[model samples]
Target: MFDVCIIGGGIAGLMLAHCLPSSLSIAVLTKEDSFSSNTALAQGGIAASIGPGDHPTSHATDTLFASAGHADAERVKLLTTEGLAIIESLLSRGLPFDANQAGLPLLGREAAHSTKRILHAGGDQTGKMFLQYFLAVTDDHVKRLPYNSVLELVLRDGQCVGVCVEDGQGNRSIIQDHHIVLATGGIGQLYSQTSNSSVATGDGLSLAFHAGAVLEDLEFVQFHPTVLTLNGKSHGLISEAVRGEGAWLVNADGQRIMTGVHPLMELAPRDIVARAIEWHWQQKGPVFLDARKIQQFKSKFPSIFTNCHNLHINPGQDLIPVRPGAHFHMGGVQTDEWGATTVPRLYAIGEVASTGVHGANRLASNSLLEGLVFAKRLASKLLSIGFNFKEKEIHLAEVTKEFALPANLQVRMTKLVGILREVDKLQKFNTDFPLRWFDLQHYSSLHIKDIHRYTACSLIAKAALLRDESRGAHYRRDTPETSEQWTGKTVELSLAGYTFGERLLKYKESMS
Candidate 1:
């Protein structure tokens, strides 16, 4: 038995494993290879208060302003305040960062920030460089098990004990551990087009909900505005840093549409930009980003330049075909300041946990900062309160023998809750294709927990339907304007009453 079993070997899990004391046995379970994570695919840099003119307060204010009054003030403050230290720690561990000739940290700008506070390494390849450094330092105390998918979360007497994971060859076994951490990232792959990796199938969110953990902000899915439309699907992300580097958004008609759309124009927040692009796409056939002005900076951003070259669309000459795609989740498993969920011995970090830092929308590079800060905080908290394990005889829950989704149901879900949403369409979806009682019954069983994937998707649809007003990434075509009171979070729980012990209370709670 180990002290901690971290599901999803992303930056958060790897960083937590590296930060914790060596005496504590930690096992990191990755569904595939270690590099298969949204963290590894992050093209932009991690935001930190590292610039000469930058400070935690300024960073915090910018984040809150970007979040548009939905952010938890205290949590946002804490994340920004602790971000500098985390950056320093990563630097000390040999994570290479870009620097000027004078040896000062080179800061890159991104949307929704008043200052140039993004600290990057190797241009747009910061994520790869950081992952490499993390892998290089991992010791024997940190056991990384790749090709392992967690089938079910093992709970005993309403407390999380371990997980039942499936191996590469489909062999299933229980990993009995005292503590469990879910850093399984976002639920983007559920859509037809998204920036998330294939493994990001809302596995962690669905697993946690089934195991009786509260999920928050299921409605606030952030869609990046500028993903390159490749082969009828948006795949490659045109980094927000491009806009920071003086790129412009232009429609197929060769008009810079953003000038009259929003006050901030290209520098506007992501939600505005995404909606603008969507509106443009609806009006015109296609949308594109004009990067011709910044051709001279191609050498500085070689990764982006090279990626565009691979697509046979040079940023200097061609108009980069772009569209909005699901990028981040502001809502996730509800957690306290210490990253502790409703469950007693369980915790969540990174994209999976709704730590209230991201609020209605996440600032461009705050994701990486949130991961680093919270990982350290969770490690410290876990180390302070040491845990002990007791091996006791327990019976496994009966596993269901079969599971499948009707093809029609999949099509309906994708249509109603895809990119755009409307009340009439949602009502039609629920009325026409209601989730069968048998599906819900099978989903509750240990062997059939994967069936809960549909349940999770249904929850998002239902929650999106309930939320009438357009705010942040959750836009409603029917309700075009933003509502004043409906400007906060939409929370969903597996069981009710604010505590994990209150298992029967799983319901929806919205706070403004």
Candidate 2:
């Protein structure tokens, strides 16, 4: 037994371990190599308000505006307010943010921000740097387990006691703890094309959902406007900061794609920009980002430059082919200010939890900050409760239920659930997916990763179908306009089906 078991050894897990008292026994579990979490792969930067001409109030405003009325006002305030202190903490731990000649942190603007406040270290290595810093701090004390993916959450009555995990060698084990924190990243890999790494298969979301945690806003999948598209699929991401540096999205005919779409044009919120690019990509064949105007283009974004160079395309001369690809999840298991879910002893942080700070759309570069801020909040909350390594008596027996997803559903999901969604497709896919999931469940050849991917995809599809209005990252052609009724409300998903507003209230009462 342990005091805490943290799934996903990313920045959130590492930082949470760092904040917890060293006397407590914490186990950090990873699905792959310890560094495979999206934290290390993040290329943009962490968003905060320490730069000149910026404040958390304005930061909060931009975030809420981008969320399109789904972000929790209180949580948004907390996330923005706590950002500066956490950045300072990370700085004290040796995260070297790139600074200007005046010795102030150099801040770069992204899509929805009101000002240039996204901070990077070593140019595009902000996430990588922070990951290394936290890993170094937590490596000695925390038991880091890689290649062990959590298959199920161990819940008895209402509290989560532990997790059932299977390693790459097919060895299965049960890990018992008083608390479990899920920091597993986004569900980007559910799509054939995405900016996220392979490990981002929504394992945490599935784990939480199967264990009876409420999932909110699962439809709000953020497709970034500018990802390098190679051979009809997504490649490396071209950070929104590239456009903030004055890059323009152009088509094959050299026509700017987003000229009249929004006031901010290329620097508009990712949802607007991604839709415009996708619309143009379909109408005019392909889209590209022309970065010739940005002075010191290679130096300002060396990572993007290197990726382009590797593909034999120079931003100064050639138009890099770009397309919208799944980049971030603005929804997951619902959590509160302390990152505690509706379920007891099971907390979620990072992209895996819907703290409702992102609403329908996530503001650019806010993801890294969300993980850092929420993990700190959770750590503080857990510390206040005190820690003890006593095993709780769990009398529950394993029960197998029907898995409701199709065998080849991942391909179907990628086809139907892209930037533009339709109710017919969503409904049809939702109906057929579960039957397939059941079939695949009995196959001994099927891996645990595949099962989790199907489950997560099913939840996303259900949530997308449940919401009939277009807002933020969730755009449906049938429901092209946002409605006032859905504002400040969320889609609550479970095995009993989807619920909303009063229906959600009744559903919980029934569960009780």
Off by over 4 Å in 2: 244-248, 251-268, 290-296, 387-408, 435-446, 501-512
Q: After TM-score superposition, what is the CA distance of residue 44 in candidate 1 from its true location, in Å?
A: 1.6
TM-score of every prediction relative to native: 0.88, 0.89
| Top of the candidates by TM-score | 2
Q: Candidate 2, TM-score vs. the true structure? A: 0.89
How far out, in Å, is residue 374 in model 2? Answer: 1.2
The model with the greatest lDDT is: 2
lDDT of each: 0.76, 0.80
Candidate 2 — worst ten consecutive residues by lDDT sum? 503-512
Residue 456 accuracy (lDDT) in model 1: 59
- Candidate 2 per-residue lDDT over residues 1-512, each given as its tens digit: 87889998887888899888878888989989977878888866889988867778888888888888778777787788898788876666567888879767888877668898889987777788887777766745689888887877877677788887777897666789889999998988898668888889998877777777788889999887788998876777997778877888888788888888999889776678888988886677888998888889888788788899999898999998998888899989888789998788899999998887888888888988999899999998988876554565654344444433455565687667778889998988888765122322222323545667878988899888888999888999999999988876788886556677321211111110
Question: Where is model 1 more than 4 Å wrong at Cα?
Answer: 243-260, 263-268, 282-284, 290-301, 394-399, 406-415, 429-452, 487-490, 496-512
